[model samples]
Target: MSNQQPPRRFTPMSQFATDYPVLLIDSDAPLRELHNCVSERLNAALKYLHLMACTSLPDYAENDINTVTNIARILVQDVSDVFRVIEPRGFETLKSQ
Candidate 1:
């Protein structure tokens, strides 16, 4: 008898269209959720950065300028935090398959 293993099957989302298009719809829900969450966080960061930029006026005192610079730095750290939270592990799974 042959010792070969059976071929593995990959299920594409389109296959759920018959009686369960809902599965396809539900499958996209996680992506949409992540998109919305990330967009909101990034927009908040941008708003904070915009406030800092606006405050960095030519006539600003040294302390005020320093504060604005610190805010910009904090926003950069916040963006990095968001990326760490949302980064996916699916690429490794695809490679293994």
Candidate 2:
């Protein structure tokens, strides 16, 4: 008598569509504009840092770093400007009152 083993059959589960929350942003809105502005500045800084780290060319890398640093300075100034607009100091305070 020969012993025969039965092959097991596998059944695959059906793929179900998953629902995900969608984030919608208005392109013409201030929130989207601010997001875009911040993204661009940060991307620029990251690219400059990447270039500086990857290349041994100090002349070019130094310039790139400097450019990023300048952009950072400008961003800082922008923050200060926004702060001023949001919370302007009184003239007396400015005059050391």
**Residue 37's lDDT in candidate 2:** 53
- Best-matching candidate per TM-score: 1
lDDT string, candidate 2, 1-97, tens digits: 8788653222122222335423222222344454455566566657755765786765566777677667666655444433332232233346786
lDDT of each: 0.52, 0.47
The regions of model 2 sitting more than 4 angstroms off are: 1-29, 57-97
Candidate 2: Cα lDDT at 54: 81
- Please report the candidate that would top lDDT against the real structure: 1
What clash pairs does model 2 have?
none
| TM match of model 1 to true structure | 0.43
TM agreement with the true structure for every prediction:
0.43, 0.35
lDDT of 1 by residue, 1-97 (tens): 9999853222123322276522222222354564565577578778877776676377788898788767666545544543443454334447789
Error of 1 at 5 (Å): 30
